[model samples]
Target chain A: MNVPLIARLAKKDVRVTVREPYFFFYLAFPLLMTLVITVALGSLGGSVPSLGVCQDDAAAAYLSSSGAVDVATYPSIEAVREAVASGDRDGGLMAGEYYVLLYAGDTTSSERAALYAAVSSALAAASGSTETVDISVERLEPRGLSLQVRLIPFLVIIAAVVGGLIISSSLIEEREHHTLDALFVSPATPFDVIAAKALFGLFLGMVLGLLILGLNGALTSALVVVFLFFGVLFTIGIGLMAGVVMNSMTDLIARMKLFNIVLQFPALVILFPQIPSWLGMLFPTHYFIAPIISLTQEGAALGDVWWKLVVLVLCDAAVLVMAAKVLRRRMSGMLHLPSL
Target chain B: MTVDNPYKVRNTYVTGYSGSAHVMMIEATGLTYRYGDFVAVDDISFSVAEGEILGFLGPNGAGKSTTVKMLTGQLVPARGVATVLGTDVSRHPKAVHERIGVCFEEKNLYPRMTVRENLQFFADLFDRSVDVDELIRKVDLEKWASERAEALSKGMQQRVMVARALVNDPDVLFLDEPTSGLDPVSAEQIREIIRAEKTRGKTVFLTTHNMAEADALSDRVAFINEGRIVALDTPENLKLRLGRRLLRVRTRAGDDFAEEVLPLDDDATPDRMGALLRAGGIATVHTLEATLEEVFIQLTGRKL
Candidate 1:
């Protein structure tokens, strides 16, 4: 590794990336979207529960019912009630004497009736009283959505795009000005150039990716970071490959758009929850997004998601090697490589 | 010191070498290239020597740039052979490229980089970090050294290009219209730099349709038409061979000018000019020198 060359290449990468408005947008916009989406989804899904309270036997029985929402138990009724009132519940239950008060946030009339009816039925079954005791249910709106959980995948995608913008623009700009030719003619080896571009792109992608994660920590997970590293490599590889393949800026943009539409989009949607397993397996992005969602949404562990990580790594490696070969061919000015 | 030497500077040959010299730094034999069905450079042969500036003149689609690209290793020859510094340009372009500098017609510098950074970056390309200040000074851009390349004027940018091309102190320099976009002063400065390079004993392959530039700097010129060398010789020799009798005389009749036809061979034109000067108010009497443009038009029946 030529340290100075690496440093110079990195500096050049940094200079070009900082100068580009779209590069910042590519990185931050996705992260912002991830934050927006995660917060929106989390807020919509409601807050996590911090405690629970049962004011009476009926409320306790209702909470314990199969249909009751499971909530983590904590100390103090007022505190739990306050937690519920404040939308802090991940969910919980509450009961009261005589009235059988069910302290949950806002719910539909039908849902309230169902809980009341559940409590009424449980009481009747316990005491052999056909007459039902009157009960009331109340709801309190929570202040904010839990956005951290929802935006993780979006942030990662944003990171990948940031990587794409930084790597692609810099590379293409270099080629357009024929600076790449000058650099290639120098003592800087092909590998040196490739490594410099890949590393620079990876750093930029991760920074933008993590910037989104920073705004909302829920987007970040160990597994996501691990897979995101590979995602970054994949983005940079494709970008450098694009740089090598296309001789002009117009061709680069056109090719980037085409690739994103035909290849990148299909792969992203293939991992949706309702999609069939075989179809999802066909897309590399499916594996990347699935593991991230599993980690942030379902709170899954790395051990459980290692296979997905492996698949992403393999895909990243394949693209990188192909990109290197394409780059070599391009420097030699052989037949033009496909844009995407 | 004696006020002047007896021998006049005009028409005096400054012989640095006593005999025929081997000044060919770049040699091409029957080079042929095609882009799809169109042949860009077809069976062209030429050689450039050290301290020699060979003006590559051609029409718009005449393959001058293509041939320069091949020599610069930007493109490989489809057929025939080329050697730069004993390295086959097609096979060992990297080696040939190391010893040469190329300034394409397009402005290819990184616009975002500061002038100093630009020179520094190119300097590092050769693994030699030059004094940026010195280069900036050389280009007469010391004041704009900290400014971005995009901010500089076209003339300033051209100077920077010349500075960058000299960063490695190359053996051969390929300049494509170095002064095309420059003003008179900047163009003259570039000519001075080219002369300085010659003093340093470097070969220059210059490509341009600017006839004045070709005449001013080129030691010999190769006129390429339709991808073939139609004529190649010294500027004076070509002019002497192809010139017609057209002389313009300026006489003081309120900036009036007169054109007279006369044989170019040595004759009594001086005596006739003396009679005209004695008979009329003559402000200026000068030769109607045929420009390279006229020569080009005469030979190719087309303008560059």
Candidate 2:
């Protein structure tokens, strides 16, 4: 409500966040990893099968004896020959010499073998017709999905969201360095400090999220973007709670590890089950990934996930209220020390 | 030193309290603070007059910080009352906080903000914007105005902390070992700033274990030991009160012969010092008196 106080706090938050090398690494490294993975491993669907097909009758008959490969017959020799050279099949079998054709960029053994099997089957079906039929076929399975496309973006989003983790660490770090006590003595309230930190961390999470979305073209749903904003708020609130509850930096770190195991790891379970309705309603970031992919891949409207959005917003409010209470108690002399 | 001018410290005769009379700024009666079953400050009662610098001297864990925390309304008193600036501290801490400035013993500057921003942040807290340039010059931090707090040396940061304490220009300033962990020169700078605040007629409640600091700045020193006020008086009065008879004086002569021992409280006995000086053989005429530290030891039977 007090603009100047909030502004000063905001300035302080920015300075503290930027000054730490770890915060920067936490903020920047994930996006970089996502970019590297996307560039290095994206679009790698098909690689290889080592099998080969021959245009000769004997080879074609041997392959046709097995029903493993599909072969198509061409009407004319010229048509068959063109199909073979054009990589419609891995190899073409004529009277004797088998010509194995490779796509310009095609490599890896499995791809070549699949192609040969198809062509050999087609030639065997032709069965030495003086009509000079030529055909080739290869059954090569393209990779299910590129590792970068499928997992990198998901990992990046999860990693980037953990900027809130660093916010909690910074709060504890300030306490260890003795700054939090000075803040307590100032006229500022614990609410003011907590709000400042949460807002500061929220801004960082947003920036990192935006960068990944922009680079990968993965974030598409405007509704999902709104979901993400609230998700960030919840994460920041959780971080503040962690910071306020812990007595020291070491305790905070240990507690954070426990939180990661208990709270964050469960999101892994949530991901595999088609995102159960109960989970979608409960976990604030439940729609965080689904909406992103839906928007990017399906061009789906974020309005479809509006309920998830509402749930996340509520989660943010609840967690933030809890965090504010803990912070106030910590700032005050609520923690009992044994009388010495 | 004896002054020809009559404006120096004098014993004022007063009979009753009146409107024009100076009132106590901080008054604690039977103040006791405990954590669970342990009492940190035990029934300590004392009062500080308006525009007074009350030295709260105690060694580590002597309940000095705990007492200060109660007085400043940071910690609720376990038993008894702490009235700061006429408001019950525990009952209305917000009011107390609004009126007082606190510079704690901890090195608690926001390491991310610049020197100027740290001061400005405090200034904004008081509902008034400060001239950043003027504040910088006052703290002698003009050279590092834009440098982040983390970049400055520890002494420099302490100076910045002092500046922050004065930003609100509060009525009462609570300094807990303000100059601790600082070099002598920087410690002197902090002292100078504190003295300047006192000159502005602000009440200063300072806590420290440093005897020289207490002796140099305190209007009245309260020696706290084991959560009790062992002795409370002006530095000179404490010294005079304890060193009753023995007045040891050193003169620039042979080691044994230069020492003059005289009775202090019994002026009626003889003017031995005047006679020695009138004899014209003494190089320097002086009186030996107990320091605040010596007096504290005498009263509390413990070293500060």
DockQ for each model: 0.19, 0.30
Off by over 4 Å in 1: A1-6, A34-150, A175-195, A210-224, A241-279, A295-303, A321-340, B1-19, B245-260, B264-289
TM-score of the B chain in model 2? 0.85
TM-scores for all predictions: 0.73, 0.72
lDDT of each: 0.68, 0.66
- Candidate 2 lDDT by residue in tens digits, A11-41: 7777677777667667667766766765675
Candidate 2 docks at the CAPRI level of acceptable
Off by over 4 Å in 2: A1-3, A41-149, A156-160, A246-287, A291-318, A321-325, A328-340, B1-20, B249-262, B265-286
**Candidate 2 residue lDDT tens string, B1-304:** 1112121122111212122567788888778888778878988877787788888898788899999988887777778899988999877766777778888887878777789878877787777766867867887999999998889998898888888877777899999999887899999988898888889888899999999999999887887877766666777766776644566666664454576677766764367777766676576545666677777777666686
